[model samples]
Target: MDLKLSERYEDYREAVRVFLEEHRSVWRQPMADSDGRPSAAGRSWQALLIEHGYTCRTIPKQYGGHGGKADILESFIAAEEFHRVGAPTGLANQGISMFVPTLLECGTPEQKERWIRPTISGEIVWCQGYSEPGAGSDLANLQTRAVEDGEDFVVNGQKIWTSSAHFSDMMFVLVRTEPEAPKHHGISYLILSMDTPGIEVRPLKTMTGRAEFNEVFFTDVRLPKTQIVGERGAGWQVANTTLKHERGMLGDPGQANAMLGRVVAIMEEETLDGVRLIEHSGLQDRLLRLQARAQAMKLHGLRLLTHGLKGEDAGVARLIVKLNGTILNHEIAAFAIDVLGELGALYEDSPHLKDRGFWQTTHMFSLGLIIGGGTSQIQKNIISERGLGMPREPKPASKGA
Candidate 1:
């Protein structure tokens, strides 16, 4: 692969740098609330980014996006510069990263016009309602029921592990619309206001001490029939589009590189035995290995981008990223803790905590990433059976066959 970028990209990179410099004060200000949800300031900054064609660039302008053509190289440059300056390229949320693309692909024009503007403009937030108490990895097993009754559907069930449910304005959810149909076929995707009567949200605190995830209960919550995205019994198909974007978001190579960079910084600043941790031979070896892996991931991302530009299927390569990227990120965070030794145990509340205990928080969150988009085991099975032509694991005979 050619390591050098062309002159056009070189110029584009400079333009990004100039734009960030010009808007330094606004972008450098705090963008999120204490719980990491986008604040008013952050939303305004995001709108500025959209106006400048810096983010949500591929979506059409009519939908409150920048409306630039898709160009992965420009996207990479923008992300890289944003990371370098510690400015957010865009608000990271299900609304923008996961659901917007899904809506663009599967929503009716009216649906698009109604939600996309407010959602992408940060006027509204949305949470995914796919997982349940019983059905997570096996999502088709979801039992949330939405019975149609006179031009409306009355929904009743509980959804767990829903991120940002408490703060979101609305949700894109899956519910059983036809009980007699096949497990995967009877479901339907629908949008509902979080403030609808009979809806309750109880946040679940994670190890990081943040309540970003929640349990959402719907008790006869009524929704309009028009809220359904695709056909009544075809939610599984619409949901796949959301899941596809979700996996890509979770496995971002840029995020992995940022984690690695932080780890390297920790190594350089930390010390043991009257010497910098970076000077230790054992730590140096580990650092080199991680650096190599980070490079490999970037190169692999370039290959995937090439395939996308050419309209060619990347096959297993795309499937493998979520698994590998999450694992590598977890390892990088763990390595940071290893470098800090006992100090790593200190959290944000502690005065002696290094980097404000960011690594400690990240280390815990990274473990969740391994399980979130799709569990590592599930991803492996997908790669094996679907990508490599391997036979799937046989199902156990039901009771006594």
Candidate 2:
């Protein structure tokens, strides 16, 4: 079997390398140019990439995207190059990845024209409104209400664990529109301006001392009738599409490999018992194992890409990669913790800390990976029931407590 990229892709890869090489130093310490970027340099650098078509390669050209179709390998290569340089890969991503495709698949022409370009250009930002305090993993049980009132839906409920909600200018949300109907059947999807009155966003800070998530509460916030993404009661299906994209976005084998590379670099530089860490047999063994796993993930991703190009079902690969990516990342982080030893305990502003306290930060972040997008438990359910066609255990309804 041919393991290498086709000649066309290889040429594209070389072009990608040379273009990314020119910005290596700038990317190393870019200023945030957009609201997402804390400095203007980072924003400017990303804008340059977008201008040169080094990012958003998967997005279609009609939505101010690139290269027409979703080119998986090209998209992978673009992200790999950026992550390899330790650059902030967050460009105009909500639109570029999740929303744009969802819109293309499900939105009206008007909605597409109104939202896609601005979002891709970073003119507007979007946040998802799926999980509520009452309904996270069991999202069908959400109680957030959106009452159809004449031409508007008056929304009143709260969403928890909402990433970038505070920074978002708009939200694509799921709300219970039919109170008496069954849980999943009653849900509806809507897009609304964040500036709408009676909406509130409060930051949720993580252990890393970063407020990357928000708790957004709505008190009769109103959106126009035209804002609904699909049929009112069909939101359960629409929301599922949005979520499938969310879970798929979690696959980034390049990021995983880059992390492993960082760990290897540390081993090469650090010494243990006056002997170089590179010479330690146990550490070397563990590192080699992680390297192997990362390699498997990369190859699996390539296999998935090939299948996708042939219009074949790669859902099994998708399911496996998500679980593999999370586990491999957690293991890498855990090993880094050991390497750091006492330095792992140091966080924030500590000069004695290794890698500027990143080891501790990544270790904490790894735990979230197991939960983010979809939990590891949920992925196992998917793998068993859908991938392997396992019989689901018979369950009785819960008795009232």
Best by lDDT: 1
Clashing residue pairs, backbone N/CA/C < 3 A, model 1: none
* TM-scores vs. true structure, each candidate: 0.93, 0.89
For 216-303, candidate 2 gives per-residue lDDT tens digits of 9999898887889889878888866766555334346566777888888888888878988878899889889888988988778777
Candidate 2 positional error at 222, Å: 2.0
User: Over the stretch 37-143, how does candidate 1's per-residue lDDT look in tens digits?
Assistant: 68888998998899888778878999999988767677777877887787777787788887789889999999999999999888898999989999989999999
For candidate 1, give the lDDT: 0.86
Off-target runs (Cα >4 Å) in candidate 1 are 34-37, 243-258, 399-401
In model 2, state the lDDT of residue 357. 79
Taking all chains together, the TM-score of candidate 1 against the true structure is 0.93
